[model samples]
Structures are given as structure tokens and as C-alpha cells.
Target: MSNSARVESPLEHADFAGLAALKINGGVILREAKLLGHLNLRGNANDPDFLKGVKSALDLDLPLAPCSSAQNANTTIMWLSPDEWLVIVDGVTEAAIEGKLRQSLRGHFAVSDISGAQTMLEISGKDCLQLLQKSIGYDLHLDSFPINKVIGTALAKSSAHIRRTGEYNFQLIIRRSFADYIWLWLQQSSKEYGLSVTL
Candidate 1:
């Protein structure tokens, strides 16, 4: 099948088009960073050659520190473990990115395209922080969870790779099967503050 025929994000069946019509002036705005590429990378961060190759290939350094990210216009790399990282890019480019990484990276490294297994949800607004606080036990204060920081944390009964993008904005990397549950949870949790859905 062609790329266009094969591409579909996890929430494509969730009728986001209907939700897009809702006013975005609410206290909580939720939307999917749909169809984006997701790549899981495993390599030695301490190896200078590996780090240099990554930068050369992606134009972004691999963030060695735990729970940190390095990003630019086309890609975002999140640290998942000491030797593992998640690279996100425009959905259509995932295959190409993986191929390039495979060619450029050498010695005890692995890159897998996980775009179909996961999806990203972005939550932002005045109440985004409060809504998050209700879901997880992590301390989200700026003093602790600064912007560009990523965390593997609990959301309701599911798990997500939570990344702080801005003062009141967050990006969640959630499993495809749990997307619906999390969406429902967001709706229920944001009732008081008012939730708006966007594309």
C-alpha cells in the first residue's frame, strides 16, 4: 500500500473533526499531535562517536541527562532511559529518519519506528497543570519539572511519557489502546474548567 493509504493515527476514529468545532477559549485545550513519527532509539550515550553521529543525522543532540529533550524545527528527541531515547518527527518522515539513523549510527545501537504503537496528546491552557496534578503523583512545579523535561508517569490508570513543553502546556506520549480512556478521563476531569478539543 502507498504511504497515504497506510497512514492513520491512533485517534483517527475518535471523531476529532467534531471536537475541532468546539470553541478553543476554554480553560483546558486538548489535541492530538497526530500522525507524527515516533522512533525508539537505543545506543550508548557516553560514546562520543554515537552522540556525534546522532547530531549529524538529526541536527539535534541526544539529551544525555534523564528526563530531558533536545528539539529543533523538524524533530524532538526525548530521553527515555540512560541508553534509550524517543525521537519524534513529522509522521511521514519516520521511515526515512530510521533509515538515516541506521546508516549513520554504528556499534551496538538500535532504532525502531514506533509511530504506529503510540500517539501524542497535547494539553494546554490555564488549568492544564491542575488537571495533571489530579492524574499523577509527580511534582510538576516549575522548580522541579522544568520545560523540556520528560517523565514516565501514570495518568489515571494508564501510563504516559509526559513532557513539559511550556509553562502550562504538556505533551503526552500514550499507548494507542489507552487513547480513548485517557480522552474520556480528560473530558471528565476538565468539566469544571471547560475542555476544548482541537486538531
Candidate 2:
């Protein structure tokens, strides 16, 4: 592929940029973190060398605790399982980051560039929790689901890896094939509180 080739997000047809221009104030705000790189990493969590290599490659410690996440200015790493993680970074940086991991790490480690397989959506505003409540069965209480926590669960009959970023903010990593369905679900579910789209 040429450098000049156009890159399109899974929700490219949704035209979120156009909707963002309307500037409608709603209780729920949504934004697509379009074309960000998604990488699925698998390795031994018990191995100190693996952890050290990951930290060296990404500049952030791998979140080893269950349903936890770690983030810095450049990347966010979510623990998917005892031995699996999902790393999100700027779209242009995945290749370089993956290369660093491959070069620095050794022994039974795997890194797959799954960027094209998923997309991320940021949901916030006062009614964001309510919107989420209508979709997922997971307890949304902060006490139960603290900030910087990640959970893979069913959302509106589909599935997503949901991460709480703040009191009223969440980041969802969803499958590309389900993007349109989730988009429509959000539209209908947030109709009562109103929905605002941001670029």
C-alpha cells in the first residue's frame, strides 16, 4: 500500500465529523477515536523478562491485575487476561512499537496488529452511565468498576472491551463488524437524554 492511500475507519460511513460540526449539546457525548492502532499481545505475565521488555517497548508497565489498565501520553495497555493484553496507540506508531517489542522481547511472546479489526469510541457527559446501563449488564458503580479498569462484556447484544476513564467517561474497544449496530443502538438508547457526537 502506498503512503498516500486513504485510511478509513470502520465507522467511516457514519460521518461523525459532519455530526460533530452541529455542536448540539446533549446529556451524552460520543466521539470516535478513529483509526487508532490496536495490538493484541500475548506473553507470560510471570516472566520478569517479559514485563521488562514490554515496559521498555511501550514505556508503560503492563497492567497485571485483573480488569486493570495502564496508560501514558502515547499508549494505553489493557489487561485482557492473565497472559493477554490489548495495546492502543496512535495509528501511525503501531508498526514501530510492534517492531520494538519484537526486537526487545524473547521467549514465547506474540504480538498481532489487530488495528483493522477494532475501533474505539469515547462516551462521556452526565448521562453516559445511564446510556451504558441500558446496554451492558455490568455494574456501573464506581465502587464496583473503578477508573482505569477494563472489562470485556456484552453491549447491546454485541461485545466490547469497556474501560472507565473517569466518573462519566468510558472508552469502548469494539469489533469493526459491529460498529454500525452499536452506533444505532447508542442513537436509540440515548434518545431520551439526547446524544452529541464529537469528532
Candidate 3:
């Protein structure tokens, strides 16, 4: 393997860095959480050992309830299903974390690195709620979708795992193949409120 080989983010061609310089008072802010590690974890939710192994490895408890998520300083665990979770961690740590999980866990478990298959985009600012309301059918009201809740839903023509990170902020986990399309859709949708980019 050559050291010169570089890993490019899925939205590399969108030139987010260039847009970051623009001084726009946009109601919606878009920031790509680029190059983060995405690990799909599966195990028996009923097994105490499985739960203990995960806690030992990540130092964070799994979110067992449907559409729930838990996060610490280094990792965010989202409950994807009864027996599966999506774990997001800092960039370049997927292999090490996976290794820890493999070492700690025993019997009937699976962990796969899916970092390259997708990307995360954070949408926030004043108009973020309105933007999301137009994009997905899910209710954005705090009563319905409170903070730290994750749901897999349709976003425009594509799909994403939408997570509420704050009162007016959301993180969208979108597929790499639809990065360009979603970027374009965001630009158009936020035209009235304005759109600003951050590196």
C-alpha cells in the first residue's frame, strides 16, 4: 500500500470548503461531519454479555428503545432495530473500535465498517425545522421528535437516518451515491431562508 493514497469524503466534489468563505446570514447552516467512522453493530439485545461487552468497549450504553440514541464524548450509538445499532465515532477510529468490540464480544455478533458507504450532514440554524418539515413527513415538533431521537426516513427523493441533536439541529446520515442530489436539494429548498456552509 502506498502512503500517497488519500481517502476522499463522499461529498468531496461539492466544494464545501469553498462555500465556507461566503459571508451569508443564512437561516439554515449546513456542515458536513466528514470522514467520521460508521459502524453497523448487531447482537442479541437479550444477552447480558452482549450488552456488557458493548459497554466495556465503547464506554457508552446502547440505546435499546426504538428510535432512540445515546452519545458520549467519543461515540454516538443509535438504535436501528431490535438487534442492531449504528455507531458513529471519530474519524480513523473504526478499525480500532471494531477490534475492541471483536475482542470483547463473544458468540453471535457482527460489526462491519460502513464509513465509506455514507456521509453525515448537520442542518441547523433558525430555519432548519422548516427545511426538515418540507423534506420529511415525520413530525418535527419536540413532543413528537425530541432531542437525541433517530429515525430512518425519506428525505426528498433519497433517504437518511435523521437524528435530532439539538432543539433546532439535526444530523442526516445519507448515502454517498445521493450526496450530490441531496446537496442540490438543500440549496434549492433553503433559497428563501438562505443557506450557509461551514467546513
Candidate 4:
């Protein structure tokens, strides 16, 4: 009976249903709880050579400087620290992407694959800013945290990779282990406005 059994996971489409409880407490929210293929790129943001390599690899310029982001349709490059950034994408195309970056940027830079290490939680709606104000310290003003800004900021008792996905849609990319706590915090925060959680 135990010859070579290949078992598939029962959890097919991420945490879509469990988010209902959180959703019921606030405005509509969508959680793209996928193992978002993520990579951390670190180097001199002003280095013209590095930028050239990055442009060649991803077909887009790297988001140099703090609180910046550059995107193509699928890949989003976000600035983390002054010298670090996070590259995010969907689907099962991680190895190819990582390999390309590694091959392209052959210098004093780091390319780390963090796919299994983090999870993405998208919190959007009319109450997105209000909900975020309760958590982070950085000014979430329209002029400050403008559209397409990617910030590595705080989220309640945890850290998150946050980005403005739309006018009202903000995405929170967090670590895997801290998810449960973040989920609880989100539920508590969105209680004032009726939340509709979807995955």
C-alpha cells in the first residue's frame, strides 16, 4: 500500500474561505495568499552597471532609492532598505527568473529566492488607509505614499512588504509564520467597516 504514493494537497486555491471571518468585519478585501515568488536584490541603487544588468534581465529598470517600485505586467520590483529591494511575481516561474538574474547581474549583488518564506495579503477598499494608519508609522498620505510606492514598513506587531496596488487596493506581503497573527490583527482592525474578505 506504501509503494510510491504521490499525494496532492487538499488546499487547492490558497486561503480563500477562512478569510470570510475577517472579511465580514470590514470593507471588501482580497487576499492573494499565494506563495508569491519573491527575491531580495541588494546593491548600489545608483550603480549604472547594475541598473543596466537589471534592465536587461527583467526588461525594466530597478526601483532604486528608498520607498520606490518599478513594474512590468507581472514582475514588481520594490525598494526595501537603502540598498535592498524585493522582486515579486506570480505562477511557477521562479527558477527561470532567478537564474536569469543570477546570470545577468554577475557582480557584488545578492539574489535570494524567498518564495516559500513569505505570503502576500492584499488589504484594499475604502477603509484601506484607515486600517493601515492604525498599524504603520510612515505617513500614508497621498503625496507621501503615492501610487506605485513600495515600502518595507511595519504592520501591527510584524513587518511587511507593502505596495499600492490601486487607488484603494494595497497589498501586504508578509512572512509565512506571522500570517495567523497578521490575520487576527486585520480582523480586529476592519471591524469598524464591514469587511468582505476574498482570496
Candidate 5:
């Protein structure tokens, strides 16, 4: 099978061409990021066999509550909507991992490769939450926004699935075409913090 069959991402756009909403060095700039293949998994948590199967295969606990996560060395599982989860794997492991999951699952369940559905933007800094609140509607205060929480909310006049990757770092998951728009928004918001575009 071609590389596209097992895993793929929409970052194939012309270099630094899709980012228009950003200004770096007084011009549009691009910051390259590392993304493993993205996967959307749907299943009910009430099923022990199904849950146990996932744990056995991934070595990561299934997050049973909303806005929660379970992590292993290289994988982080985030709750995405009810009865659904998002799995992130380093490098290219979508295809083989998808198959392994299919074999491990039974009963009502569905999994789809969404590596192409969204591109990742890693926006992080000491003042990342300040910038995040400027871009998103969710309350970014530490009292409200704790670590390891996932939220699908509007960001910078666009919709994105945002996840907190660290205390001051976050991963914004947005559609392919909006890459430039969101990237632009980040720089614009970060300007107050003396923005520095690295790659």
C-alpha cells in the first residue's frame, strides 16, 4: 500500500504558503511542527471487554471520564466527545495501529484515520494561557483550565479542538485550510509577549 494508505497528514501544502493570519518579522512566517498520525476512535466505555482490549494493546489506561486523558511513553489518549477518543502516536503508526485496534475490538465501535482531518499547531510559552484566552472562548485560568484536559471550542474566529499539552504549551487541532489563519492568529496574539517564531 502507498504511504497514504496507512498514514497521512494535510501538511503537504506549499511551504509557508497557507499561513496568512500570522505576521512574523513583520511578514508571514511558518513554524513547522511534528505530528504523529491522528486517529478518531469511537466506542462505549461501559463495555469491559472493549475497554480491556484497548488497555491490553496500548498499555495505556482508557480515560473513563470526560475531559480526561491516559498516557504511555509515546501515546496520549484524549477524550473527544462522548463515546469517542483521540489517539496520538509518534511518527507514522496510524495504519498498523488502526489494524491492531480493529482486531482487538468487538461489538459496537468505530475508528477512522484523521491524520488528514486536522493539522497540529504547537503554541507554547510562559504566557501561553494569556494568548489562549485571547484566541479561544474557554476560560484559560488555572482554576478552570487544569492540565490534561481536552476541549473542542472556538479559537481565533475559527473552530479548533484544543488540548493542553503542558503547563504553558498547547496543541491546537484545526482543519487543513485554516492552518494559515490560526497560525496568523497565534503570532498576532503572541506579539504582546514579544513573539519569537522558531521554525
Candidate 6:
């Protein structure tokens, strides 16, 4: 079968439908950012050619600052290391984007599709910060983790690429194998605030 034909979200078996039916309005809102394209790219951050090629390919810059990201309407590039970045796009466009990058780049660079190995979770709402504080060691203060910032941090014994997308909202890129564990962790952490699931 084609990859797309066999594609399945890590949480496909989870009962999100039941969770969504809960009448209680939760202070913590969770949603799976499933089936998105994830590309692990390693290139020279100091190379103007590399940066320009990526910009030309994705219309977004490679964030040079530590723990920062650059996002456009359809893509986000998260800084993973001085020489590495994670590029996320709509699932259908991943192959095309990677192709463009490969064709446009020169010298030393590497791009690997990692969509099958990772998934994203959108976490937000009034009590989201408190829930995060309970789950992660990173400081969630606005002064420390402002919008558009990304951090590789520990979350309930698993590691996630956490990005602050808004004041109370975050996008977590987590390993597929650990999806259930993280889901359970979130459920437990947000119990006091109630749990709301969105598709």
C-alpha cells in the first residue's frame, strides 16, 4: 500500500470522540496536530547559501536564535540545534517541500522525513500553564518562554519539542511511541481543570 493509504495517527485508537462529548468546559484544551509533515534538517546555520536556499524553498527563514522558530501560513521551522532544524508542513506537501529543498541546496546538508515517527499536540486554555508547570521542568513564564520560542524539554518522563504559539497555547512535537503515555499524563495533570479534546 502507498504510505498515505496506510497512514494512521498514533492516537487513532484513542477515544477522542468520547472526550469531546464531555459537557464540562475544561481549563485545559488538548488537540492532536496529527499527520503533519515533519522534516529533520541539518545544515550550516552560518552559511548564507543554506539559509537562502531554505527561505527560497519554504518562504520561511531558518531561525538562527536559540530556541526560536519561524512560521509562515503553512509551515514552521523550529530550531533544534545550531546546525539542525525541524520543518513542519501539511502532510501532503512534505514530499514536495523536501524535494524543493534538496534541489535548491548545495554543499553540505541533510533532510530526512520523520513524520511517521512523530506527532504534535496542541495544548492550551486558562489552566494550561499550571498543567505544564506540573508536567515539565521548564519555566513557562512569558518573560522566559515568549511566543515563537521552542524548547526540547522533558514532559512526564518523555521528551517533546515544545513551542509557545500563544500566551497560553503550545504545540508539542512528541514521539509516536510515547503518544499514549503523554496522553495519559495530560489527562492526569489536567484532571483538576477538566479535560477537553478537539479534533
Scored by lDDT, the top model is 2
Candidate 3 global lDDT? 0.95
Per-candidate Cα lDDT values, in order, are: 0.91, 0.96, 0.95, 0.77, 0.73, 0.93
Angstrom error of the Cα, residue 84, model 4: value is: 1.2
Worst 10 residues of 2 by lDDT: 1-10
Between candidates 4 and 6, name the one with more favorable lDDT. 6
Q: List the residue pairs that clash in candidate 6.
A: none
User: Please, what is the TM-score per model?
Assistant: 0.95, 0.97, 0.97, 0.85, 0.82, 0.95
Best-to-worst order by lDDT is: 2, 3, 6, 1, 4, 5
lDDT of 6 by residue, 73-186 (tens): 999999998999999999889999999999989999999999999999999999999999998999899999999999999898899999999999999999999999998899
lDDT of 5 by residue, 1-199 (tens): 5666443345544344333334444222224454577788889888999898888767788888888887888787988877999888765788888888899999899989887767877666666767777777888866676778888888877898777766777777788778767766776777777554554
TM-score of 5: 0.82
lDDT of 1 by residue, 1-199 (tens): 5556566777787788887885557789998999899999999988999998899889888999989999999999999999999999997899999999988999999999989899999999999999999999999999899999999988897999999999999999999999888888988999989988887
lDDT of 6: 0.93
Flag regions of model 5 displaced more than 4 Å: 1-32
The whole-model C-alpha lDDT of candidate 4 against the native structure comes to 0.77
Candidate 1 regions exceeding 4 Å error are 1-4
Query: Candidate 3 — worst ten consecutive residues by lDDT sum?
Result: 16-25
* Candidate 4 lDDT tens digits, 1-199: 7799552212223356775655465564656657567887887767888889888988988876568888898898888887888888764777788888888886789888887777777878888788889989988887888888988777896998789867787888887778767777877887887667775
- TM-score for candidate 2, please give it: 0.97
